[model samples]
Target: MKVRLGFVANSLSLWDASPAKTITYKRYTELPKEERMDRLQEVTRLNLEHTKRILYLCAAHEIELYRLSSSLVPLATHPEVEWDFHTPFKKEWRELGDLIKKFGIRASFHPNQFTLFTSPRQHVTDNAVKDMVYHYRMLEYMGIEDHSVINIHIGGSYGDKEETLGRFHENLKVLPTHVKEIMTLENDDKTYTVEETLAVCQKENIPMVLDIHHHEANLSERPLEDYLEAIFATWEKRDLVPKIHISSPKSEKAFRSHADLVDAGFVEGFFKTLKTFDQDVDFMIEAKHKDLAMLKLIEDLSTIRGVKRISGGALEW
Candidate 1:
């Protein structure tokens, strides 16, 4: 199909200027349970507003792949803690299903950072799979045909790559067929890169969600194009690579500052190289400013592709 560009909603709440706003990771974690719910209600309402803005951007230039975070649906029962963020079966999920159709966006529910596939905790991985699987089933049961994806990290590289891949393979076999089909893997900041991720995906017959920034940040020794080519080559049988996590990398900032937007240089160079690739890909901008990052990325794509700014065109340049 067509290539798409969108944003991650995880950092969208950082823009709220409410005096008592506690939608942040710090405030949400430490705030009393009662206070967390109150603030979450406020942020949840704001999420709808943000969705409207996001839809406008995607509609303006016909961007594809709206990468949505699970946090967008507020858990009124337990909104603060990260554990409760995985509420795929919640009532809000049904509402979100309708909203995805309403907005006409192909949405994917991105799992939380705490949902590590190789966590030391016994239940961390199982519970993570539960949340991810639940999201796919709920939307499917709702008859939402927009095509959703659950993006995941290949867990910590830890010591041995082959050993970790073995465990990951076992875990994939346990996943339900529907959930397994919807699952895609992304390169993490520490353990994995697009190439390594593709290796695991190739073995398991799953697709990949390439994060350009993650590979660069992890002391990657290869050229950017090499990584991209390897991933596409490995998944040559697939018609489309579902999603990519893009953002401006702030070397000095932590994930908390994930919103720190990257400039146009990387975006410009990257999309240009993409034109040579034969595979179709969808993208998500994971910046401190998701909406703005998407807008800038679209603009850069248009400039690089040398296309007139037309409404509802898949490629920008």
Candidate 2:
């Protein structure tokens, strides 16, 4: 497989017009479901149009477009007047499938953030698992799962590391496995860096996603080399080595502002770091401006590698 650098779409597309300038999960959760659905409907229309526009922009600039999958769920939900367990989505699942098919680009969803397979809450894990199953099924309905798998946040850390690992392994054993080999686990900012994730991957035999921004925020305070060592340690023992999830050092500078790890300089450094490793890996750039950030980063990295390729250009999709 060729190396790829994509971007997470949610952060880039759904910006508020407010002065605060940061997206909040709470704000999204607080909106009425109806209202949320309505807004998402509008965003989908615009975003789909924008995707076409961006293809041209990227192609013109010699950039390659990679679409993250999670950003499409709201659009996947059937937007009907009412939603109930019987009709998880208001609209037909086929409708959602059609839209994704029409988009005709590479996209994948991240695993459920609110999903906890190990939650003590009797129904929490079950419902989350159902949603996850639906997502994969929907991807199949859309004909995307055969080629794409959604990214997932490895549930919560749950305080006890050993217990958490044990539960993850136990829980996964019972889950349905319908999607292709694209499903991947990412190291998050809150818990589990790449090295720790690597250990679990060794046990579970799953793919890895190294979120560089996450490592900087949580693990890089110690010597970066040690953290990198942690990443290398499990590659051989694990069935799949994670080299995806791209970013630069993240800052706790505020409850808000962060250094733009998606910048070209960081991509250069990341590519440099990768050059020393003797394996193939795929990376996704999760900068503040998903696609925009990735365009610049990949361009810079490719230039550094002395190769050249242009995207489909602004007019070609």
State which candidate has the highest lDDT.
1
Q: 120 in model 2: Cα distance from truth in Å?
A: 2.5
The TM-scores, one per candidate, come to 0.73, 0.66
Output the worst ten-in-a-row residue range by lDDT, candidate 1: 13-22
- Segments of candidate 2 deviating more than 4 angstroms: 10-65, 68-105, 179-182, 220-243, 249-261, 278-280, 302-317
Residue 149, model 2: Cα distance from true site in angstroms: 1.6
Best by TM-score: 1
Could you report the Cα RMSD, in angstroms, for every candidate shown?
5.4, 7.0
Q: What lDDT, from 0 to 1, does candidate 2 have?
A: 0.53
**lDDT value, residue 191 of candidate 1:** 79
- TM-score of predicted structure 2: 0.66
lDDT of 2 by residue, 210-287 (tens): 776676666734544445555554444334434467766455464123345555665556556665654455566666
